[model samples]
Target: MRISALAAEAGLPVATVKYYLREGLLQPGTATSATQASYDEHHLRRLRLVRALTGPVGLSVQQARSVLQLVDEPGDDLYSTLGRAVGALPPDGAEPAGADDPYPRARAALEALGQVYDPEFAAVAQLEGALAAADDAGMPITPERLARYGSAAADLAAYDLERMPPEPHAAVEYTVLGTALYEPVLLALRRLAHQDAAVRRLGREA
Candidate 1:
């Protein structure tokens, strides 16, 4: 297909496709002439992935490019590529957990439950930030709560991993896309659960 067809198939405009090409986000098509080129299914698939990152995943173009760079590298290990992807996101007011911090304690508790993951993984900044916020709110998290949350997260991770493909590239794609998309679902469920708990225990909506 040509650039117009590629754009149409990817559900984007020709101008946007051209912009991506200019930005080095899209690889150049096979040159059929000085003014014409041919794209294939690979180009379409990559374009779709680019759209997925910049649109629903909410990455800026630069961030999307960084993630795509890792994704496109044949030699990059999947998990490490995912780590960089997670790491690339802006921090949610969280730093890495200190030794005495509840975040590390939570990860440790997770380990005790036989659900070991990298405590230092960049995304854990979210947990550390949450722990910091709880402390700021005058309700410091206890080790027990951390353990329970860790265990629950581990359960969810297992479910998530079960659905991932065995291929490295596919697995990395799933990891990135799933994490980006499912956060809203998790937040909604949490809100619903909180409402239910409040009604049951406090006899009022919170």
Candidate 2:
């Protein structure tokens, strides 16, 4: 397949495909002549991944590149590779809290749930930031509530990991893609569940 065919198969424009090639987001196809090259299924698959990153996943080109880099060169340690991939996700832009930090609260909550995590992990910092904000808003998450949420999240994580690919690169791609694509579905389900619970428990007629 030529670049045109590849782009057509990917549902992207030829110019966009060339742009990706130029940006190193898509690898150049095999050279067949002075200016012609042929692409294969691997190229098509990568193009789709690139589209997902830049389109629905809404990552910048650089962020997408970082993720692809991780998939390309996954290290020996699976934990580290996955950790870096998760860290590449867009954050809430909350810097670490200071002396009055709510990080201790987050750490304590995780400890109570028997969750072993890196203190320096992006999600740990995200949790701390969220806790601090909630405290400031006078709606702090109680330890009991944290435990409930943590339990559900743990189950969800286990469910996700159960279906992870065995190969290293495929595993990394699966984790990253699953996190990005399915997060919105999870959030929507949560909101819908909230509505259903409200209706069921509050005697609301709807």
Candidate 3:
């Protein structure tokens, strides 16, 4: 296909596609003439992945290029690549543990989560502290329970990441479909939980 067709198929403007080519996000196509270039399906797939990484995720062009490099590498692990990218996002709030804090509980929780989940230390710490704070505020989950939950969560996350297809186009579609469907699917789960709780409460009373 020609460059124009590739741009259309990828749902990006022609100039955006050209810019990606110039930025090395998309590999150069075969030159058919002095001004015309012919792109193939691989280029189209790469362009779509770049669009998703940079658009919805807000990765900078350079960051998107880095991600594309990982995706293109023959032996690169996509799960690790995505974990690193997610870990690079800004930390939520104050440092996980205060410099002068005497207690080691928060630090310990974070370290435990990091050992179990392999996320960045700070990310794990932030998650742990959030769970702890929620429990302290009587959200019904204790630190020990949260640790077990984290283990289960890690297993589910790894499974989902493994299920993603290796091809760039397939990856892009997987992300799009996940974003589109996950919220409603989760809402359905929440509704099921409500119904189950109501039924169990009535059964116990009976």
Candidate 4:
């Protein structure tokens, strides 16, 4: 297929596809002539992945490139590649909270749950930010509530990761895409569950 076909099949505009090509987000096709190139299924799959990353995943082009780079050149281990891919998903420019403040709270929360995690992990920072905001709002997540949420999250993670492919590239792709796509489902389910619980407890619409 040609670039136009590739774009059409990927449900994108030709100009957008050209832009991706120019930005090095999409790989060049096999040169058939000075003005023409032939693409294959590999290109189609890559194009779709690029669209998913930039569109639904809400990553900047640069961030998508970073993730694609990892997919193209997975490092020595799947675990590290996955960690880096996850680390790359969040938009850049999140200034770390002061070391002493959020770290202690976040670390303690994780410790209370017996979670073995890197204190410096991006998610730990995210958790710290959430905790700090809740504290400021006077609706702090108590230890019991934290433990409940932590247990549910752990179970969800297990269910998600168990289905991931063993291959490094596929595993990274699955992790990134699943994280992006399934988060909304989780949030919706949580809200729905709250509604159901309210109806049960209050005996009225909630």
Candidate 5:
């Protein structure tokens, strides 16, 4: 396929695709002519992944490029690498999580929760602290409850990746699926926690 066809298939603009090629995010397709490059399904797939990372995830092109490099590198452990990368991100509700300063938003969220539900808030804080300590010890996110999350997530992500016709498109599909899936799962867990607390309170009164 030509560049235009690749861009259309990926639902990206031609210039954006060219920009990715220039930035080394997307490898060049075959050089059909001095001015024309022919792309294949692999290029289309990569472009989709790049868009998802840079678009919704708010990853800078450089950050996405580094991640892509890690994913593509042979013999790299994908799960461990991804765990490290995500653990390095600031706690939830933090803005510009990269800055060295404390995450005021996350702090505020905790403070608000602490006001209304001290025990629950304390539990969440302990969990967060434990996860941080584990990360510092070079452990993956091994909280069994948290690790069990992958069971629900893996199938959805696999389905999305499989939906992409060409095998190479799996990369792009996985990126978008992760971005789309995690948020709802987190929210659902929060709701479940609240429900559990309510049920426990009712049982105590009974």
Candidate 6:
């Protein structure tokens, strides 16, 4: 397809496609002449994925680039590819915490959860970073509570992984897309559950 047709097929503006090409988000089309190029189906698919990541998934250009780079690298197992995708997100912007941070105590709390986790994982860093932030705000969470949350989150992950398809790339795509899209859905459900609990425990007879 020509650039115009490629943009039309991808539901993107021609200028935007060119911008993505220049930004390395989209590959350059096949050179057909001095001023003409032809894109293919792969480019179309990639453009859509790029839009999805930047649009609903809310990744910045650099972050999306990292995720796409991981996707482009073949030979990663589905699980590791998904990890790379999630890890590309910017951290919580709190100061970088180390293995021995007294404030959040997240490392100790995570250890107490009884699961071996990579301390270097970006998600772990963000979690522990948020814990440190909470501690700094004078609302330190007890290890017991952190354990509860961690266990529940593990359960959620299990459910997610168990339901994934067997195809490796499909599994990777589903994991990345589901994790980004369903977080708010999960939070909303939690909020509703909280409301129900509140009413059950504290509501007056009416």
* lDDT winner: 2
Q: On a 0 to 1 TM-score scale, where does candidate 3 land against the true structure?
A: 0.62
Per-model TM values vs. the true structure: 0.78, 0.92, 0.62, 0.91, 0.51, 0.75
Stretches of candidate 6 off by over 4 Å are 29-41, 76-81, 93-104, 165-168, 195-206
What digit string (tens of lDDT, one per residue) describes model 3 on residues 50-114? 78678755678986776566545524455455554444333353344544542245555656678
| lDDT of predicted model 3 | 0.66
Candidate 1 local lDDT, 13-99, one digit each (tens): 999999999989999999999999999999998899889888877889998888787766725466677787767655454655455
Backbone clashes in model 1, listed as residue pairs: none
Better-scoring candidate (lDDT), 1 or 3: 1
Better of 1 and 4 by TM-score: 4
Worst-scoring 10-residue span by lDDT in model 1: 101-110
Q: What is the lDDT for 70 in model 6?
A: 73
lDDT of 2 by residue, 113-188 (tens): 8988556677887877778789999999988888899888989999999999999999999999999899999999
Model 1 segments beyond 4 Å from truth?
Answer: 74-76, 96-119, 193-206
lDDT, residue 16, candidate 2: 96
| Tens-place lDDT digits, model 5, residues 1-206 | 98888888888898998899999999988888898888887777778778877876667888777767654651345444444344322233212334453433334434443433222222334444555565689874643544365455556556755554433323434443464446667789879998899888876554
Cα lDDT for residue 140, model 5?
A: 46
Q: What is the lDDT of residue 106 in candidate 1?
A: 44
lDDT of each candidate versus the true structure: 0.78, 0.88, 0.66, 0.85, 0.60, 0.79
User: What stretches of model 2 exceed 4 Å from their correct place?
Assistant: 98-102, 202-206
Give per-residue lDDT, candidate 4, residue 5. Answer: 94
